[model samples]
Target: MPRTAATPEQRAHIREQIRRAAVEVYDEKGMEGTSARAIAVKAGVSVGTLYSYYANLPELMRSLWAEPVAEEMVRLRATVEATPDPLRALRALLEGYANFAFDNPDILRGALLFVGRVQDTALAPAPAAVEFDQMLRDAILAGQKTGQIKPGPAAQIAHQLWAGVHGALALPINIESLDFGSPKQIVAEMIVTLMASVKA
Candidate 1:
């Protein structure tokens, strides 16, 4: 007899289970400690079945790590476009990003840890990473044209601002022992500082 076809919902369910399982394992036992077999067991699927969904561990990690950020990036792009005011648009965009990072602290931590030591081969350019930077660069350029921001290289300024966000968010997530303010507060303050510093 031919195998019964799996419905789209069933496939989605299984994929979600696998992703959640990976997250749990990665959380409990850092990325290095977790394996595909562990994730399969946690997901209640055979190793073969897990492989059917993801070719390997990195593929699964990539999906779990990058998918949400990509979605956020799309939303941010739309939100910024909707508001023609560059200052308000940029504020909203940065705030949205900080909220995302704050909400998904564990995932952000995992991503930072995983990327730091690993070679470039481990990560593809995140769509959000590229798109967010581009949007930021454009915002800076706009501000410059309006004489609201200093005239300089938009790319470099964008990089500095982006780095400030990532660096501030990363410390709280990575070093659990270190005392720090909430991620939201840090990000908000960082956003203000960065914008103020760039003002003409």
Candidate 2:
């Protein structure tokens, strides 16, 4: 007799298993070295089974980040919204992002930082990422309105701040031999410097 198909819960469980296995494989070997077969082996599932859930390795890799990014955005939105002072809110958002990245280095390197070898626009910024950018833009606009932040395009300022903070957090992780000092301290100092530069 033929076996019954997997239930919705079973499918979700299998998808998560595949995603976790992908993260491990991704950690062991960078994106260029990873393959469906390798992930399937790590997941203890057939290559065909892995393909059923994810269209390709990049898709699986993208899945690894989906939840973490969304969750982080939610937390940031809450933190920004709660702080009344716009300048304080912007500082809080930046610091909160640093803390999250430090806390989840695996996810950071494996998903957030890793741009796949292929140049696919489908892999463009997620909705959560867009939301994150909007959050920064909004915070900057508020601060500028209050004359706490320097006058400039809020979106550009937001992008610059994000780029600076991300570079600081990513450098130590990407280069193990470099004695970059504590990531937390580096990020804190970087945030202060960036904020000060943009101060009115």
Candidate 3:
């Protein structure tokens, strides 16, 4: 039976505890092997309790991983927002992107895998993706208006830049022996190349 909580504070605490336990289990078991019963035992709750908070295993995992991804996205958006200059803003964005992936490789990998699998089937996007798209689009449009970026459709330029940045980061991370000097260095170079491509 699920533990009954008398207060909102207690319920919130139990929910956090369950989430923490789920993250630990995910670390060991990966998503496929992790189960609600397993998470319940680790969390000291009933499987039904887990279900009460999260409708299903996928939803739970989504919430679990979304925390880190959302955090990184916030940092990325803030970094971009802090610098009004187009070029400097782009550099800061690139660095934040590289740093997050480097610092949280496990979370990054899990997110990438989950996103790849469910992206086609899932109609609703996690909030981070939406924020990222908006920010990047705005940035590109701003750059074009400032004459820092070459004349092109802001939408196409934003899409290309976004894809390029991820490809630049994703490549060396996936291939250990690919031998980029460092993730930051490669990302910096990639940013330069991308900036040049877009520069007026």
Candidate 4:
């Protein structure tokens, strides 16, 4: 007898299973060692089956992170927009970003690895990354207009804010030997310093 085709639900389940396996392999082997065959073996599927779901390992990794990052950006944007004070809105945005990174360390790590590997000049910025940058720029611009933040190029200020906060969060993750104390407190202090530098 011919086998029945997989239902949508079953297909989704299988896809998720493959993603979980990929994450596990990534954790164990890092980006340099992870491969389609390893993930397929971990997922209990053939390489052909894995290819059918994802064109390649990079595509599989992108699928894992793209939606979560986009959703978080939307939530952060709403948080920023709700605040009447521009300075507070910027604070809220940075805090929200810190919270997301802390809450989803594995996803964050996976995303960083995926991005580092795929940094080709020909590739366009990911939609979520572009949205995140624009959100920061918008907050910075609003603050500058109101004399809450110092006058400067909005894009430059946005980059400073993003880079500073991201460095604070990424340091402990990359250098575990150092005593960085609480990441939350570190980020809060970093925010304060960054805001002070840009304050009008």
Top model number, TM-score: 2
Please give, for residues 43-91, the per-residue lDDT of candidate 2 as tens digits: 9999999979976666778787888889888889988889989999999
- lDDT score, candidate 4, position 195: 83
How many backbone collisions does model 2 have? 0
Instruction: Give the runs in model 1 whose Cα sits over 4 Å from its true position.
Output: 1-21, 35-59, 116-122
Residue 70 displacement in candidate 1 (angstroms): 2.7
**Which parts of model 2 are misplaced by more than 4 Å?**
1-14, 27-32, 41-52, 119-121
Better of 1 and 2 by TM-score: 2
> Candidate 1 versus the native: TM-score?
0.73
- Candidate 1 pairs with clashing backbones: none
Clashes of 4: 0
Lowest-lDDT window of 10 residues in candidate 3? Answer: 114-123
TM-score, every prediction? 0.73, 0.82, 0.71, 0.78
Cα lDDT listed for each candidate: 0.79, 0.85, 0.76, 0.84
lDDT, candidate 1, 1-200, per-residue tens: 99997899999999999999998998898866788889999999998999888766776777887867778888888998898877777678777777887777666666544543332435466566788889998888887888888889999988887788788887786687988867778878989998788888
C-alpha RMSD for every candidate:
4.2, 3.1, 4.0, 3.8
TM-score of candidate 2 to 2 decimals? 0.82
Judged by lDDT, which candidate is best? 2
Against the correct fold, how does model 3 do in TM-score? Answer: 0.71
